[model samples]
Target: MDIRDLLLELARTYDEGKGTSSGVHAQDLLRRAGEEWRHLLPAGFDAEGNGGSGGASRTPWIGVYDPDITRDPKKGLYLAYIFAADLSTVTLTLQQGVTSLQAKLGEGEKRRRYLQSRAKQLRAGLAKDLVEGWDARPDFKCDVLRARSYEAGSVAARTYDTAAMPTEISLREDLWHMAEVLQHAAAVERNLRDEMASSGLPVTKRVEGEEEEHAGLDGFRPKDGSDYYVLIRQRKIKKSRSHEVLVRLFGEYIEERGFVPITKKMHPKDIVLRRDGVEWMVEAKTVKRGNPTKAVREALGQLYEYSHFLYEEQGKGEPFLLALFTEDIKAYAPYLEKRGIASVWKTVEGWAGSPMAVAWGMVDEQ
Candidate 1:
């Protein structure tokens, strides 16, 4: 049977009691489901199915494993297809291994809180729209500790009602995309580990949003600009790992062109490119599909604000303002130029930029 049929059959026949006829049937069907799911596995990945230990389980699942990250669900990141307690819906999820967190943080509420917080932080690495309809924490009727842990450790998921399951083709596509997303997360996590190592800090010792010495800037210096501090405090700046990735890439790109790029802890700007005693402040923003304008709008404001408070107001002179985007914001190039902000955005081949940005030698014309 296909995926839809398998899910429907299992959902219709699932029994909660141990060793019941329906329970046995559910176990057999789940095994077949897991076997079928193997076809959807990406290269170098493997799959496993679990119906229950001795009896039946409230949540039966098939786990897809990347050996580099984990082959066991108790220790690392993996993809899982989990059936709800009521069998009303089945969700495909990218989830962390909760036992590992428990080992590190100890069990109970402390571990639970850390699980959710870590998931939220890692979720930032993914694009907003990529997981727009998914839950960051999926609670599949946490009657058992395993079920509760699954809810606590969820990173992202797409759920489908059993009454209307998707076709096998769409299921395959979703699995592929989810796997790619998992791979991206792995790469970013490794980069962060390397960064921590280079800074001579243990990976476990770093904390997000930890207080650090503020960079010398009007917005950050309370005595220099209380108004700036008040304004900044009121504005809730959303942190994003996708934004970090873009900034790093852009910084490397500029550095390759013989410019020095600087980013410091608690820095107001994304990047500072310097050459020949001249500096350009860059604000990097990641673009979501169908929302390039929103990215441009945000970057524009940041570019202007940083230039004013970090440079112009401080008599550092107006450093050149540049807005960098993950994708082409060329549509707003003219709009930004009229306001004295140079715009440069990424393209598959190289980079694209506003005329002023090109003239300022920020990016090569594509």
Candidate 2:
């Protein structure tokens, strides 16, 4: 049966008026279903708790099901169980600690004394539970299975003897299940964050790049031959310092476009595209990822700097294009537009075409 069907059946069996089965609600039924069919679920948190400001801290707990059961063909047989924690118990623990701490602090500055005493008691209680709980429960055999320990944020693996069960499961299989669970949880968290943001909650924004307006040059003939000189200067600097991959890509693109691409290794200005005695200076930048990191900002700034040099030194009166090549356009497009920087946001498919290019026009002084 499908997951939904199986869940419904479990819920019906556990319904209030059901026979010997406990009258658990649908949600609880679903939570315990993983344990009932432990052989079919992935491993992870059995219970997750998110606390509100007024309540106590809830510790998340997870259940691991035996992976040897082969009853279900669709989902194998192993499933890890998860359930939500009760908030009342968490609140009580917090209240108890607070009361004890306050009473001790009132008599003297016994902060360390109170903390040490409380910790000792807590550890003792946990140890007592571990010894008694495992020993008393026949179903909880330590020989076949071991409880996994977690350090800080890292999870240690719990392994069970597959040969002990009817089916032979491996440690690798258990690890794979654990990894899957973590990945799924992460996706869920991201979805929750997106939902919260969409619900008009205040979100933090991290701005990494300078916010400045830039303009591209339009058709305007330079009075002097200084524009050519500046272009030469910037090109030289760019060729010397730019990545080899970028340099090769730029050269190939220029050649394919049938434009004379000149590289000056001195104090160069812009990448000049000359055709039919007309020149279009393009300030180019290569963006690998979409996120606006320092490197991305620096590349953009370099592009703008080259544009400035072209307008001031070169006699080319055409609009300068701030051509950017990147796989991720959504993240960087708005920022580029906000800064009044003309950009070409392109994927692999559109990079060879001019339609993907966006140009921010510059004002010409008459």
Candidate 3:
């Protein structure tokens, strides 16, 4: 069934009374809806729906989970579609898990307060622009305790009134948007954990919403044109160990070639090579799973920004732009070349570069 049809069906047929024909029908619709939602997701994601147990639930929902984030709704983050207790509205939300929180604080008003506070932090850590259209503070108007907790746990949401239900395309778009937000959150959490581990810092329980602590970024503050500023404001928050290593290794390679590589603390670009009045602004990114496209894209943006602000804005001639990666970004090589930016990546034999880089003597043809 179409998403709107499924939602409308559940809203109209959902019976408050237990064991009623309509109640059974609602449960079946929810199950089928879950399967349909599951088909819309990518390989690593799974969708499931809960229409209530024994009796109809006050707020039925279909949740999408990434195992890398958390399978259970008791902890970690996920995207879900929750119908109001009265079924007057359905909300698509990126929400936190609250069951574990209640387990710690016990049920009552204290738990409710903590849930909202945690939700605030979750919202704070993510870039506001990423989920721009969603409401940061949404009221689900649920009567039951569990449903109320879900409302308090919401990070961001978009509510649709049943009377003015959304089109199928709109519903799918919202679902995909929330999915991207969840993916971005998982990457941030992963980077934070990696940063902590590399520094020998104990990885604290992330389930409790304490994941924003930046132990690895101690003594580091944001500065315009610096990595810290770009990372924090642009949602590239933490630098992984591999990223650091790649930069260091590339610097050494440049030094051996009789060029001076400016440290990041002294400059905005990852590695700025200088010798004989020539400068090459090199931005390095470590590719994960051999997919260098995301890294390449980020490097491209940073490269242009740093070049404009640090050099051109000050009347300095535009520096040679180079996009460096941990793996081959060959697919983007021609694209970068068209824009007069060179491409380079790590290889088993040594460093490899695009034709422009080769002609510029950044690396020999290989």
Candidate 4:
């Protein structure tokens, strides 16, 4: 059968059963798919008693799940093709089931490093082979199972819609163009394996009943508010004159000039400065990477919320909400400015920008 016939058959499965799957229907669909494109499919189907979904109550869609490796439900992989009821659309999905298991490899700094590096690698690989109309989810529901899905993993999916019945040539071209999305998902799995091998951290076998750690940054939000502080405690920032060192430098810059600066005294903020009849709340974030993307975003949130907490203690005065980034983030300056927050970008030598940018009249008054 050609691509057109496969599409028609998928539609028939959905139309006939209306998303209610039985063992017989599942076996039949698997047989048809295996017969159609056995050469192009990935591994794990060659073994004795290859696996397929028995049946599912999949509303609005009829689907087949072919597990290449299902020995470990949390760490294997699958290729899925499900057609919607209308016969006008179908979705192809590829996912790595072990992603959540990998993300929780270690407890602290080591895990953070692994997650950050792995995120970068997966993002790069997906972008490298991504196709049109396909949207990439970098975190892809790692540990959390959404109500819509059956398992957790890295997933890249896209839908193809045919306004009318597609001709053989049209279906073939359509399949070829969309095949890259599955390849993209497969590439993500490969990148993750590379990340794991190169990490060199001591691998600990997971204990049963262990909870999975969700990768921060879905998965964009930074995990721990105390991470930068943990670096401070470990003295890892002392030997290296990195962005993290700027936290103490900038805090001293405030205090040495007669402003009283306190660390963690304010709620949800790294530092708070008080003097001259005004309070200046600051969130200090440092990154060792090229761009302080997640750090800066998290800092903005902390500083904004800290301002409110300070207001509860004090009053609704035009106090300063400041964000200090160790990297050059002039592009993000406008965003911080719009929120009336003054931003300071630190260079290896020193810093720039003053809280007076908010026009609070405190600069001259002080």
Candidate 5:
């Protein structure tokens, strides 16, 4: 297996693949990733998660998780391979933090001790070439978060320099590191007070929908999700499964029409759409129950920027807004139209295409 080849495939196919023409959907991602690594990954440990805005990002990555251990990476460590925009480089990371960790490992000295011991051991090994030459320290990677409401705290990480090592070294370390790094983390997850996670090993089945909170993120928000835009950009976290699902569904809609999607082509829009000499962009936002208004409203601004900055200014394509919802948001349709953008949502009647969609000539089917 060529490391460069893998990086190319990750950056290209995952970042801008065939199914991605319409947009990258969750199933497309899962299928693509599951196929790519099923041969390499452990039976229960699947490589998943379409990183950063789903369509693509400067730092797009796919996370490998042992579902039996803990799906939420913040609670425990998951292997993540991140690719650069050009697909010319990559970074293999250990997904870690307090919320996801607490969900699996719980709180107090014992948990901290284990993490520190493992962290120290990793540091010690890297020093002696037990692992490849890489900066394995929290000091360099920690981001000092600004949460005015709470005490200022930090999250650190060491940026991976993909150019530093021989191909064999990076490839060998990736496999070796994945198997070794999370074994202890997975084993001790049973110590968590949550009954479902009390068993320290993989399970015969999987459960859906666990209520988790990001205290760090919420601290900066004004309870009404008012500071959503300000706080969201500052969040350096993993993509939600729901977001992936929405992308997948939207991707399907695009594929059926045989339209190819150019993802993250413009920074503001998640994916750019084109057909019949009519080109446009769509910025998708998943609806969070309490913050539907905020999510849709912010999406309007993002769509406008993608169009105005990347299209209109440069004499290019049109821009549109997409709000993915598991429930009805027809009431917000007029709001989107008022902003001069098309609104899209799901319904029992199939995709709820707003009047703006027909008016803008974006969805030919509409």
Candidate 6:
């Protein structure tokens, strides 16, 4: 039998079985046969070769045997043998031996076209809705109106049909309007709070319109509208420079402890924290479950450089700490340790809770 015919037969057998053990075996055999054929063929044949028995034997082929999509209840498996004239990619039309399969393929193409046309219509309708909606609204303000004016004056609006104009113009206008409105609202709230703070009254008490809730205001507001002096005391106690979540946690643990943990303003890569009044360099690393790549190794090297800088250049006689924070500690711990690098693994607890360590490093002896 011809090599191509043999491959097709194997694919057909596999397809009839619907991916059973025999089907998988057939597939493996077909793959090996293809690989062997490619090895025998000259490399230049793929680029451009003469049309002869050797070239005919080297027809590009893929064997697929799976459950038929067209068959009622999809009984016995079917095999698909696709052949191309050249090694370069080509679409095969299976016009013979699989009439139902061909019909299904045609149906699929039609459905795809239908879906594409429907998507275009939906997009056009959405664009129209946005423009008409914004124009209809009397309260639209700021950069939105400015952008709309520009869009309305553009060449596309004048030259193209209503459906052909880009949808982005409407979207940009709506987004700009929303941004301006939100900015105004925020400004109003901030002004109100500042004014209340100056008037010796709690901002929470002066409920002029809707109450504005700012971050870190929880547990700071007093039940009774007490003197602004009382509110100020609470505010000072709760305020911290870090993220609100971090601030709240630090507030509960470190407040009144006299341990003024200075929040480093510099990048983690640049900042070096001091221990015992001496410059102590620490490298912070965060990793997920995947094996460390070359990028990770580079980052680790960068951290090492930062540590060396602190010790040699700054003359801060303190040990370095390599803090490795990871979700999966067990998987990465061994890998990191193999590199002779000491690491601290921290597991995050619930929100606003402290991170619990599966294992941590002692002060680096090196």
Off by over 4 Å in 1: 20-23, 103-107, 191-366
Candidate 5 local Cα displacement, residue 326, angstroms: 4.4
Question: Model 1 RMSD to the real structure?
Answer: 15.4
Model 4 clash pairs? 217-220, 217-221
Cα lDDT tens digits, model 1, 91-114, are 999887877655555666555655
Candidate maximizing lDDT? 3
Please give, for residues 1-366, the per-residue lDDT of candidate 6 as tens digits.
Answer: 333334344434433223323235554455455343331211101111111122122222332211111111121111122322222221111111212322332324332332233222322323342323232111112233221222221111111122233243332233223222222322232323212345343222113455344454455544432333345333533221212222233323322333233345533332344435633233433332122343246436755654554344456453443433322234444555554444443222211111211222132122
- Candidate 4 regions with alpha-carbon error over 4 angstroms: 1-244, 313-318, 354-366
TM-score of 5: 0.36
Candidate 5 regions with alpha-carbon error over 4 angstroms = 1-238, 264-268, 315-326, 358-366
What does candidate 2's lDDT look like per residue over 255-329, in tens digits? 665667665632343355566776555544433212335435765676565555555445435444444443244
**Model 3, range 304-328, lDDT digits (tens) per residue?**
8777767775578999998887657
Q: How does residue 257 of candidate 1 score in lDDT? A: 81
Comparison by lDDT, 5 against 6, better one: 5
Report, for every candidate in turn, its global Cα lDDT versus the true structure: 0.70, 0.33, 0.71, 0.46, 0.48, 0.30
Of models 2 and 5, which has the larger lDDT?
5
Candidate 3 local lDDT, residue 243: 64
Backbone clash count, each prediction separately: 0, 35, 0, 2, 16, 3
In model 1, the worst 10-residue window by lDDT is 202-211
The Cα error of candidate 5 at residue 71, in Å, is 4.3
Give the winner by lDDT: 1 or 6: 1
Runs with alpha carbons beyond 4 Å of true place in candidate 3: 19-23, 187-366
Q: What are the per-model C-alpha RMSD values against the true structure? A: 15.4, 22.2, 15.9, 21.9, 18.8, 25.9
Residue 58 lDDT (model 6): 28
